[model samples]
Target: MSKTYDVIVVGARVAGSSLAYWLAREGYEVLLVDRGTFPSDTLSTNNLYSNSLGLLRGMGVLDALLNTNTPIYRRAHINFDGAVIDGLFPESDGITGCLCVRRKYLDQILFENAKAQPGVTAIEGFRVTALIQEDGIITCIEGKRKDGGDDIETYSARLVVGADGRLSKVREWAGSERKIAVPTDFASYAAYVTDFVQEGEMHVEFYKNQDKLAIVFPTSDDQFVVGVMYPLDDSAWMERFKSDPEEGIRRLIDEGFGHTSLADRFRKANFAETVKGMHGYDNDWFVGMGQGWALLGDALSFKDPAVGQGLHDALYGAHMLSEILSQYPASEWKRSWEPMGKVYQSAMEAKLMSRFWIGCQFTKNTPAPPEITAAYSLVGSDRQATETFLGMYNYVKEPEDLQKEIGRLLSGVNPQIPQK
Candidate 1:
């Protein structure tokens, strides 16, 4: 007989493992399965903001994360078409800062915490191929051990979750339809580097250019993550990097920063990890809930990393679903899964879809218009506006609110409203 569980989550990285951990605390019997092992690296510029840190703190995983000694970045610099904005991430409610820890370290921490729970049974190296349905309802998953042998096995669950990411197998098998999907017009390349010097060790810098955008983040273990997003259709750029990524990335760095004093600093930096990139994926949101199964994290939505929102959005997805699921404990979840799943799905769409749209727009790689740059400079000059603008990523500060505040600041001055 196949083993049974209250829930079975596929893809035990950020979203899967964290959801298992959260659900386990709610007294659910969870079977968490992943095709890969823990401490494995995945594709991400996986930075977490204050709101995500607050969620982790609430989940009791913050201290363990902090123990890894990832540097907490309090200040930031955003350069838009040569206009600079400098500010601090606001500290409130004990959520003090941001960090871009390596995914291997971060995922391992969440996975370890999850599998340790008595209510959770975590399995690694298991490739789930298909779902088993009875009377048209998904009841079990079937797959084989990735390394032990070819023998296939099965595990049953009251509900199955697809946290498997962009090309989610579970999402495919479940036939979750897309509601709003936008193809990414730009491609991203990122790497971790050593000896990448900066004035402030606690600063993250973003440089937005006409045809590309470049970002430099100070990350854990005394390393920096430098990334660039270029127009995907640019054939010359693709040809230049397709074979020798190192030379290409180095050239990109040399060119991106060549105009600034920082150019010499990056020229001396060495790679801590090889450059990795993403291409041909859509920044989209899928229907969040379905019968007998639900989607979480990148399985449900994937946005351009340009906004640095993907990691936090995944954590937020887990937290949001868990919040709704908490209302109906494991014992009663079977009866409530569909209805509450709809509620959760609707809530996810309402809360996050707008941001995904914004991320889609960012792929255009156009420089910020002059008026917007001026407004940014205005906002950056004001400490309060700057902090609140930083808080926009955390969702604590709404876009409309920021616009209003900017208007208030511009009220007294003769604002240069651009004409058609």
Candidate 2:
């Protein structure tokens, strides 16, 4: 008889591993499979804002992550054009700062924790080749070892999940159609630097001149991850970078930030690893839930990476699914869980839609509106205003709230009510 499980999760990265961990904690039999092994590096922004950190803490992996010596960034310095806005992260839900741990280390921690769980079985280096369906419902999956040495394995499950990411085979197999899709015109390149002067805070530097953006994130082991996003129309420059990544990144930094401390650090640093990058980050969302199967993380939806929400959304979405599944028995998953899964998918897409709109504004080759420019000035000088603006990124405040605040500041209307 083929082995059966309560749930079979495809792609054991952030989404699969996190879901497995939570489900196993609830005493569900979970089989988590991944084509890639643990401790493998993938393309990512890799920074966790305060909200994501809160979720990690709730998952019981925060302490282990902290032990990795990932630098805690308490403040952010954002430079748009010549306008500078500095903001301190507000304390919330016991999280006081952000982290910039590499995915290689962080994903390994999550995968290992899931593997050690009592009811979770993790298999790496196996690719799911087919979904077994009976009477229009998924019943099991067929997987083959990448090495071609082991026999094909078949596993039955009450439910199957695809956490496989943007290019998801499970999504294809299930015939999930894209509901909304947008093409991207930008590419990103990033590298890790060591022996660079550590900044006391995270730096988000933007060059409005040519729609270039760079982020300097201090990560574990006294290293920094410097990333740059630029227009894909400049293919020659991108190709030059691919030919000589280190020099390409160095030149971009120097031209963008000049002789500032951030650029100086880049100039003096040594490459800790080879630069890696990706192109065409188009946002995509598909019909996520169906009978006996569901999609999680990038497999369901993805937004542009410019907002740095990929990892956070994946982890948080997995947590949300696990919470919903815990309320129902595996036998009734199709009937009881599918509706809730649809609700979750809608909510996830809604959140990403907001961020994607904001990202579009930044990517355009035009000056920011005067109101936004004025808001930046206020944010640079006022702590409350800075928090309010930065708070939008953490979902503490909405984009509309920022607009209202900017309007109030521009109108010279004091937020304080007049004393009667």
State each model's CA lDDT, in order. Answer: 0.82, 0.80
**Model 1: residues with Cα > 4 Å off, grouped in runs:** 329-338, 413-420
Q: Model 2: what TM-score? A: 0.92
TM-scores of all models? 0.94, 0.92
In lDDT terms, which candidate is top?
Answer: 1
lDDT of 2: 0.80
lDDT per residue for candidate 2 within 193-252, as digits (tens), equals 888774654544334434677877778888888788777888777887878978888888
> What is the alpha-carbon lDDT for the whole of candidate 1?
0.82
Q: Please report, as a residue range, the 10-residue window in candidate 2 with the lowest summed lDDT.
A: 201-210
Runs in model 2 lying further than 4 Å from the true structure: 147-150, 198-208, 259-261, 336-338, 350-352, 363-367, 415-420
Give one clash count per candidate, in the order shown. 0, 0
32-96: candidate 1 lDDT, tens digit per residue = 99999979998788788888888778777788888776888888888876767788887755787
Among residues 3 or more apart in sequence or in different chains, the pairs in candidate 1 whose N, CA or C atoms overlap within 3 Å are none
